[model samples]
Target chain A: MELFLLSNGKLSGEAELLGYAKRQLLAMIERRNITSAVFVPYAMIRGDYDQRAGELSQTLGIKVTSIHHAESPAEAIAQAECILVSGGNTWMLNQMLHENGLIVPIQRAVREREVPYVGWSAGCNVATPSIRTTNDMPVRNSVVLPALGLFPVQINPHYIDAHISGHMGETRDERLAEFCAVNPSESVVALREGSLLHVCGNDLRYFSAREQGFKVFRHGAETREYQDTSALRSLVPFTCH
Target chain B: MELFLLSNGKLSGEAELLGYAKRQLLAMIERRNITSAVFVPYAMIRGDYDQRAGELSQTLGIKVTSIHHAESPAEAIAQAECILVSGGNTWMLNQMLHENGLIVPIQRAVREREVPYVGWSAGCNVATPSIRTTNDMPVRNSVVLPALGLFPVQINPHYIDAHISGHMGETRDERLAEFCAVNPSESVVALREGSLLHVCGNDLRYFSAREQGFKVFRHGAETREYQDTSALRSLVPFTCH
Candidate 1:
């Protein structure tokens, strides 16, 4: 079983996210011996789902079936060996899941059955317990969608430390600290560009590109900093029960 | 007492948004004798708040007496004539409230004391019963911040009816309808640019600047389309205790 959470798609196929490990991600899928993939994208409503699926198939060198409508989701996953969820409007996607009751079945497929699953941005948010750490706001209460909760900790994909270079004081750091102070039990993993929090079966490691490292704020402990994503993952082991 | 939830500043000046009625906003404020104002901008950093409030003061020609932190928001409202909230990020601002314990007090002020409260973006989301209608994504559990329930419905501010001029089937319309189908009791208000849902002491109205309007939805009922906020005041009286 394998699952990947990406903050965003690599503009040209290069995953430029910190705390995200591309090599690790590839290895996980290889271990599952799964090539057939399903890409669920509700964010891009401008074009047909087939266009996106074809592009993913071309890029990943694997067959990717697109699930645009809810009815197609179950069938798409049935034949697919792995699931890859891309980023878009998390709220809209969650709403779709709740209304359609896909959250539970997906969890079952990924956890109990060990079917490989991957997600980025909104997808990453769904891997956690709640949809609280997402950057998207809840525009309508109609989207009361709970998360899949595969991981106990929250993932901050596209975890940008500074929006721009040489920013000001009370940075995102300050706000993150404030978050930790309020909810000490909940953990926040900040993933920068080209980074990933890798969890292979039972091996969980945090990987990053270059010197970019993400921060981890676990409950009750002093806010600890990491030099790489693997270092953060070392703290938490993903034991599929 | 009065509060004007602004999409931008200069409702009567340069900071005014694209689809709202400037004269109506000014009249609402004038009727309340709002000489002083407090700018609440928890979504943005302190620097952004400072700049936004400066613009509002320059345009309105009113003294921005205090810039209250959400942690101690009531203190800012105590002696103020009006409370104006600016737009930026709702999740971060909501996080600030959770850290500071401001949601309950702000709601209390608006409900009991009649503290005229205005919200834009994040502030607007909190004003409703929940922040379920925002465009932001809480990618993780850490992003779970409590929201204020000033209004019984959710506000999808900066509602993008269409991302591009000619796209697919109505994205915003369909998504909103989907939201209403799930949540039959709560209403969803889509305030396009330059549009607002203005609430004064016992009077709630829809004010529009250009042609843009709001779409309201309730449970098990046909969704209603409103072109002007003013008409809503009479349709739904401020009778909620």
Candidate 2:
């Protein structure tokens, strides 16, 4: 299985979507000799699906077809060389994936067929066990907390330590702490912006476009940030050394 | 029917929990000759319930009891003179409210018995028709989106226009816009920190310690900020004028 789960789609100055992960994406595309990829834009509430696919095509130099146009989205996933998901509303995206019957097909493509899967933000959120760690608002009534369990651990994508001064709401750290308190046994991977977790077979690696580190949060253990993948050694089915 | 739906609990310079709305709260308490108020601390994950009730007691000059100690929580709500809900997590609060059968009791108290309902942050989110407009993370697995319809329209509490530099995630405005887009006919009131919406019998009013205006969002209509209550005229039941 090959997965590129990014913390976010774009960086500060980068204009293109997935600009931070460009080199890795291009290299992966070239190595696999992939001709086309299917784009999952269901999570995008305020975005144009075709425009997003067009941007990805221009960036990756590969044919990117939005799955929404397909009469059979599951068939699109079954025959795709790679899968790309947009970063938008997680709740809507997960619900649409379930409603459209694409969850199992995408999972089969990535797990059994070994088609590469790339998702950022909300897309990266569904790659995990559940969407419990997402930061997006629950803008819809029909909410589905569970997502594709392609990645074993729960991930908090677009994690940040910065807080707006005088904002009385709970900070990001506090929210994650609350999550840890509720789900004591589960651990969360705090993926900061510009970071991506690449999973290839049993070999899982972490990369950052800004040379920044990622943080691991657990119930009782102290949350520590790491500059390399060595800190993720405890994760299941991965040798981080 | 009396309600004080606060955007948040505390402000920057304010030491007490409900310091900003102190005078108004005291005036209402004295006017009604209320003896005691029940504090609903279910939303508070990290904070102590008893301590919160104690703080409210000192601040409001009324006996405050945390409802967690009651043998039957619904009974506590039934016999309460007022309900004060704390601000921590909206998801957990809404779920617990539904699970413990406090929704109808609180609704009866506020709607029939004329019990004053005071809620901040998560509490404020639950006052609306649903919890979809809340800004908190959905940490709990058994999620409940619906809430007591004490307020007819949806509300986004702790609403701020400030954006962290370099953050690529959706802004507060964008999130509310998505909500409006998805639920086209519905409206959202974005309440900034230190602001509140007070519903007293048929007369509804708005207040802000920071003297800031609240923004109203609709599907295709332009989002406009207003210091007066005239903008909320179209909302159901409530006479915003």
Candidate 3:
């Protein structure tokens, strides 16, 4: 099974994280010997398809297709060489995945050595069990999405949740704290902008500008944040096997 | 205790409920012979407050002050002849109520005859204890602003989530099924757009456009939608008390 996951810092015409994102994607391809990849941009609503999909295709120079237009994911899977996912509303993207029952297929594609999957923002989030810990809203409540479980740990892209102290909100720290209270065994990887996480055959690691705490609940123990994912290795005993 | 809960019917605006709300407030006032009321507009974040508040105040034709600007709810309670709340975002409004610790005081004001309180939308929602079974997302989160336990039951407002059956979502019926699965005693009132539930001093009777079912759950019992809240009364046992 070959899989490649690429996460951009941020996207939107305003945020210029694509250069670094391209570097990250190219790095993954070079590492995995991947030739061409299919781009899945489900994070966006069905309305802005042409513009967003068109740009991503032009930007990454890959074949971008809308799974929403296809009769089924099996059809979309048929044409794809490799999978590259763009970032947007995590809940919306998660909802789309759930509404379509594509979780297992995507996992199967990776498992069957069909394609290496690359996911950014929202795509990066649902790689774990649930979408409840993200900074997005349930604008349309399809939040009960099935997880690909590519990573046993919950990846909180835009992990810092910058608006924490200013918005009178449950800060990234507090939200993770609450999540830990509910899901004790769940590990959270708090990726700041520019952080790159690489997963090759169950060996997960993070390469970034800064190393900060990746908090996890220690089974029946309390939640605490540490400097990196490796620290929580003891907590997640069987991540590989 | 003088408490007024503002609700919207299938098509009515919360502001329009002001008239019905005013009548309830008037009766509460006359029963206690009150002369002043404090107006709370904490939920008007996304609306035109100046206009809506004016119409609401004029409809009641009663003097109301915005507790939104108040430093403390005690100040709002002590100053108001009656408390009139407007609607907007529940998460935001609930955050304010929780941050300011107003739930207890508001409940106290109603119980001790200190003031008559009027609540709408988000305001009415937080009147119950657990909003975990809500149809809305915590677009924002707050540790302090838990819902008041005025009612043990959770409400799913604007119930009848998207009518698209094939859509990936837990319908109002499904959410109650989940709710009942754990807390058999938990009763969920699905308030359609036009329903105004008259929850007065331990008595919760429906006053709405249609007679919808109140899904009830009990341990070791079959979960079913009843003809009305009365059918769920056996579940509420306390309403009789």
For this target, which candidate reaches the highest TM-score against the unseen true structure?
A: 2
lDDT of 3: 0.55
TM-score of each: 0.58, 0.99, 0.51
lDDT of 2 by residue, A1-241 (tens): 9999999998988898888899999999999999999999999998889999999999999999999999899999999999999999999999999999988999999999999999999999999999999999999888888899999999999899999999989999999999998889998999999999998888888999989899988888899999877887777687774
Instruction: Encode model 3's per-residue lDDT on B173-218: one tens digit a residue.
Output: 5445545544555556665544455556666555444455544544
- Candidate 2 stretches with Cα past 4 Å from truth are none
Better of 1 and 2 by DockQ: 2
A16-70, model 3: which lDDT tens digit per residue? 4345557666665666565555556676542376566666566565656656567
**RMSD of model 3 against the true structure:** 14.6
* Evaluation by TM-score, superior candidate among 1 and 2: 2
Each candidate: RMSD to true structure?
Answer: 8.8, 0.9, 14.6
lDDT string for model 1 (B1-241, tens) is 2445544332333334322444664665677677777777776632456667766676566676446543456666555566766665566677666666666666666677776787766667767666666654442344553477666556776665443221211245665665565555556677765666766676565665656567765556676667755434433556322
Task: Report residue B58 deviation for candidate 3 (angstroms).
Answer: 32
- Choose 2 or 3, whichever is better by TM-score: 2
Residue A120, candidate 3: Cα error in Å is 1.9
Specify the CAPRI tier of model 2. Answer: high
